[model samples]
Target chain A: EAGVAQSPRYKIIEKRQSVAFWCNPISGHATLYWYQQILGQGPKLLIQFQNNGVVDDSQLPKDRFSAERLKGVDSTLKIQPAKLEDSAVYLCASSLEGGESAIYFGEGSWLTVV
Target chain B: AQSVAQPEDQVNVAEGNPLTVKCTYSVSGNPYLFWYVQYPNRGLQFLLKYITGDNLVKGSYGFEAEFNKSQTSFHLKKPSALVSDSALYFCAVRLYTGRRALTFGSGTRLQVQP
Candidate 1:
């Protein structure tokens, strides 16, 4: 079975530019998540969606970060007017269920904001 | 509020020796723990999870973690480490109640010397 799929494995943008990352979860997975991993740090939860509805996004930066999973199968995370602190890897993951389930992750989209 | 803590920043072990990476977590109710490994410039790969039923959970790449409820710790362990096992390890936890997203700790770097 194929694992989670992500696109644009690497990205670079200026401080005021915008960037986006896409993710396609595993088949039949019901939970999708977006995480940000700064260098030398662990993955931080940015947003989580169960089906088309958001489950949690408390840690997300509301001002510039936004994510949506319209069809529940694919997701997109966007950062508008990126900052230097936004230079990190954006990871997309999926699980069979919302809670108490093993999650699988994609290769991640690396973003370098200059 | 849920949180995870990885006490060590880096650990060095000779190949074929035992290794351990420590982690602790805090949650209101029951905790769901997880361990993930990440190679350089890559997304996290699920190593193991401890939901219930067992104290010791074995996972991929011959890695195992023991859940100690009394101490609120879940430390990843490998009996015989290999040079390929050098990577970053992260520990995560979630409350058994409302939120389903995980809170990850700062990662620990494992360096296995050959």
Candidate 2:
């Protein structure tokens, strides 16, 4: 089976610019997630979507970051007015409906904000 | 609140030797533990998870994790390490209730020398 897919494996933007990342999850997956992985740290969940409905987004920066899963199959994560701190890899993952299922991730989109 | 901690920043092991990576977690309710591996410039790959049942869970690439409820720890282990096994490992946790997303640890770098 095909794994989760993401676009623009690498991206670079200047501070104050806007950037967007896209994700297409595995077929029949019911849960999608967006995570940010800064250097020297683990992946941090930015948002989660359960069938197009948000399940959790408490750690997301509302002022600069936004995410949406339209039709529950594809997702997009956007960061407006990017800062140097936003330079990190954006990873997208998907899993089956239940919490017991394992999550598979895409290759990720590496963003470097200068 | 749920959180995970990887005590070691890096672990070095010679090829064919046994290796261990330590992890601890904090959660209000029952904890769901997970292990993921990531290569350079890549997203995380699911290694295994411990939701319930047996405390010892075997996962991909001959890796296993032992879950200790008393200590609130889940340490990843491998009997014989290979150079290809070198990567970044992350431990994650989530409560059984409330949130559906995971909180990841700071990640441990495994360096297997050939």
Clashing pairs in 2: none
lDDT of 1 by residue, A48-82 (tens): 99999998898899899999999989999999989
Taking the tens digit of each residue's C-alpha lDDT, what string does model 2 give over A30-97? 99999998999888899999999998898899999999987879999999999999999999999887
TM-score of chain A of each: 0.97, 0.98
**Highest DockQ scorer:** 2
Please state the interface RMSD for every predicted structure, separated by commas.
1.3, 1.3
User: By summed lDDT, which 10 consecutive residues of candidate 1 chain B come out lowest?
Assistant: B94-103
Docking class of 1: medium
Candidate 2 residues lying further than 4 Å off, grouped into runs, are none
DockQ of each: 0.74, 0.75
Compared with the true structure, what per-residue lDDT tens digits does model 1 show for residues B1-114?
889999999999999999999999999999899999989878889999998988999999899999999999999999999999999999999887665787899999999999
Taking all chains together, each candidate's TM-score versus the true structure is 0.96, 0.97
lDDT of 2: 0.93
Runs of candidate 1 with Cα error greater than 4 angstroms are: none
